[model samples]
Target: DQIILLKDGRIAETGHFEDLMAAGQTFCQLISEYAVTHRGQDGSGSSSGADSDNAETQSQDMVGSGTGGDTAAAGTTPTSRDTRAKDAKKDAKKDKKAGIIQAENILDGGLSASIFLRYLRAITYKYATLIMLFQVLMQVCYVGTSLWLKYWIGQNEDTSPESRPSLSLFLSVFSGLTLVYVLMGIVLFWVAFGVARIRASEYLHRIFMSRIMRLPPAFFDTTPLGRIINRVSSDFASIDDRIPWKLFEAIGHAVSLVASLTVVAFTTPLFLVASPFIALIYYYVQKHYQRASQAVKRICRATQSPIFQHFQETLAGVSTIRAMNLQGRFIATSAERSDLYSNSFIALAYGIRWMEILVQMVNVVITLLASLWFVLLPQGSVNAATAGLALSFAMSNSQSLIWFARTYSDLYVHMIAVERVQEYAELRTEAPLSTAPDSETGRALEHHWPQEGRI
Candidate 1:
């Protein structure tokens, strides 16, 4: 065995421990200082542990079940050996499952459209044909409502009595439209939310976790468990719980937008001429807002990782922190991290709110135009009913537009989570497990080269 010691990048000593001690005064003094520190720590730790043992005993006993059971057997149980065995096995199974990696988590490259499509396919590919057919039926019914309204209003116009709809006809038409709408809503909710969203979230989690398990140890070495946990738990929570609904509903609203635009174009022919300009404005606004919001959301997500990481580190080392009397320092650090995360979130929120204000102003303009044409021009048959119907569609579509934008943002952020998971999953793996000694230097490396100290 041999030892090589360095100071300031230059060799200070290279010898066995006894030889070093005989030759180096500084090394002996450093060793003595460490010994004193260790003794102090051991003495304080024993005394503090004595006070905590009784209070912490139950927790320790629970964790130690089916092991020696030295603490547990004293008070928790004596003959409940089978129960302990079952519990021990269950815990082991859980821990093992948590760490095990499946072969299914492989990913390709970056978050390209193909990757995004792959993700969507995992959620929706099975339902493609059915979903399309169902949505068509729903949109037809949704659009049909406006047509039905036009007919229903015709009853109020003065006409031949026989030509007018009878009481039964009116009731039947109203009931039919209501029934159709209710059915559309129910079916969309069940299929879009109940089936697709829930299953997609679960599959995403499986993929994310499987990938995490397969990641190299070096990935975890640099990343904090808290940050890792935040990505899987809270970020996944947002995607699983809300973002899917946002996406599904956004799609549903797109159908509504088409239907609304169709009605508006038919009732107010003038709007048809202006529709292209309106659409161009919408496209531009949506593109600009999406870019800005997505970028802000990414910033927020990045900032959130560190908050969780710092909090986890602090909690894990609280005892050591207290021993070192660094409570104020750690608390300040946690607060600083929290503040940084909050600034990003606050900025994101303000940006979305600003966009909302802009969208609402546009909606007001739409409503005003619809109303002003009906009031001022008094074009033939541009009655209150016609004006009101057009205005109502305008309002509905505006709300749908707002929600669609918000949902798009949600979708973007959630996809970022999947992308982050892929980041870990796609890390270049260490070469396949070695079966033979690596090289000539392996033998020397295996020996205890540092005879006196760690480098």
Candidate 2:
């Protein structure tokens, strides 16, 4: 009944095919060109005329009933294009309903204890305990080394030979403590930490894979492929490559900070007077920074999935897009998605820098307080050796504090990946592939139900 011809994204002709042909307009020109292109292969002018009549008749039938059978009988159906367009619209609606990718979740408050427990379970309690034990031993050796150095310095300053230890004895004890510290570090970092991280990675990955494989078809339908890819690729990359190191460094820095604080307190009791105030400052700074940083990181992570989803969509429709001359449009869309992710990432960077500046300022305050307390102390109340030890640890405390703050923040941020992986790992799986013979469905089947092996 009607023919609609589009030219330069606008309807150029709309009427009955016969009328459009009679008009000698855009539709007529297109038909003429198509006929000329097929004339050689079609071979007969009468056959071409028959094809044109069939096309017109099919178009009329399609306009009337919109059915496939009538169009199929015409031998060259244009209704497939309409069917495809309808399908595209339906998909667009579905995409709108389901969203291209589900938003990534950001957990509220501090990271729950369950996340840590889950990671520990992945590594197993035995390995976790062993790693902690090694860490404690390493810290003990480190403290012993510092104490021995202080003792050796005091002995050298003693004027009475009878009260002084020999240089050889000092050297032997110092070297032994240093060697033990190094050995403990090797065992903790190389053996314990490495094994634990590897086990956790393998276990989590296996669980994620198993659950994903057993997930129901509906899960995949609602969740975009790019979201799944992001989890398996970017999230797992953080778990496997980044989290372990951050966790190790965070633990190390925390332990070192504790040990240094202890040593400083032991050598200079006056420093303890300022400990509570310093701790309060640190707590507030960390709490404020962590809340902001975690939120920014979550946004950064969430925005990343759309970029992947958009890229996947673009690749999947590249051919159709090119045919429709939509390459520039797609490029612009890609840029928009990328910009969203980039903006979030930039915000995350700024948040990190803000945290770093605050942390460094706190460090400066600590160093300055320690130096003032030591210098203004009563004469002979603190020995030279003890004062020197406290000052040295105090000076080094800045690095330890900065690394502790940095690695601790990074550890929590990276744990978000593990949390995501754990979520997928615990998804409700579909029914088992095999059933027992005693079950109802299984019992109804014969041992050789299909004699010819056909369903």
Candidate 3:
């Protein structure tokens, strides 16, 4: 058995384990002290001890490598825990030197282009055509309900009671549309989110776990187990549990936005003249907002990796922490990690606030302009139906525009997690036959096969 000793974080002694133990050196002294202190037997040699002694012994057995658990193979020496830790760090550094995360991946294109579409392809490819047509039909029905309600209100204002539809007919029509809306939600929840999200998460988990298992040992050296778990577990949980609903809501809002704009332009054709200016402002504001928000969110996500890493480290070394009474230091480190993530989140919230203020101000101007145009103009110039429809959109125009921007931003942020999971999904693997050929293995075979086969 060999023993290597470290002092000032540098190796200070190297020799056979039996020689070190006989020398009564630091290595032997540490082992004896640690075992006795952990075992909690009265160092005073008194036999009378309280129940606390028994409790401490039980705790030590759970945590410590006692005599029963300390057996190393005959040819092996139990290296100091500190040496094992240092060796692990060295291996991780070696792996990092082999393959590093690039600046381009972090700063520019880490989030793949059209990430949401990627998820859609993963989850909905088989039924994509059917889903697309169904979504359009659903949106049309939704818009039609609004249109019908507007027309009915206009009819009540302008037409005689005798010319109007009976109360029962109006109630029946409204009730049917209401039922249709409920059914749309049910279908969206059960089929769109439930089936799709669960299946996608399951498939992603399978491939992700498979790749992880097949990865080279060096990969695990550099990457903490917690980080890997964070990616496929918490990160994917967001994609599975949250992204589907967010995507569904985003699609609904987008359809509503288009439908509202189109309805306003069609019924009051002059409204299209103002549409471009409002759209230009909305586009500029949203673009700036997302740029800032996504950057902060990226930082937030990066810092979060360390938080998970620290949590696992603390958990595994809890006994050491308690023995050294460094709980305060560990807790402070945890808080610091939390604050790092929270600071970025606060920055994101501030940017959102600024965007909301600008969006609301623009909305007020648009609202006033629309109100004055309808009010100052001759009464019969714009029909009651058109006026009602146009004004309704104008009243909530700010909210819809802001809602779209927020939802778009949220979708992008969520896709960062998807991109990360995808990165892991594409990580280099070990047992590969049908998958892409391993470059190193392929090159070696190509170089040596000719020489071996020439015989």
RMSD of 3: 14.0
Worst 10 residues of 3 by lDDT: 68-77
| Root-mean-square deviation of every model | 18.2, 12.2, 14.0
Off by over 4 Å in 2: 1-109, 160-164, 436-455
Q: What is the Cα-based lDDT of residue 304 in candidate 1?
A: 74
lDDT of 1: 0.64
Candidate ranking under lDDT, highest first, comes to 2, 3, 1
Residues 92-207, candidate 3, lDDT per residue (tens digit)?
56887877532223444335666667677778676544455556667777777887788788789888989887778777887787788778767766767668777777777777
lDDT of 1 by residue, 250-353 (tens): 66667677777787777767676777777777777777767766666666777777777777778888899999999999889888878887887887788778
| Clash total of candidate 1 | 0
Instruction: Provide the overall lDDT of each model, using Cα atoms, as 2-decimal numbers.
Output: 0.64, 0.75, 0.69
lDDT of 2 by residue, 131-218 (tens): 7778778888887888888887777776688767678888898899889888877888865557888898899999999999999998
| Residue 248 miss distance in model 3 (angstroms) | 0.7
Model 1 CA RMSD to the hidden true structure, in angstroms: 18.2
Q: State the TM-score for model 2.
A: 0.74
Q: After superposing candidate 3 on the true structure, give the runs of residues whose Cα lies further than 4 Å from its correct spot.
A: 1-110, 126-132, 431-455
User: Model 1, residue 188: displacement in angstroms?
Assistant: 2.4
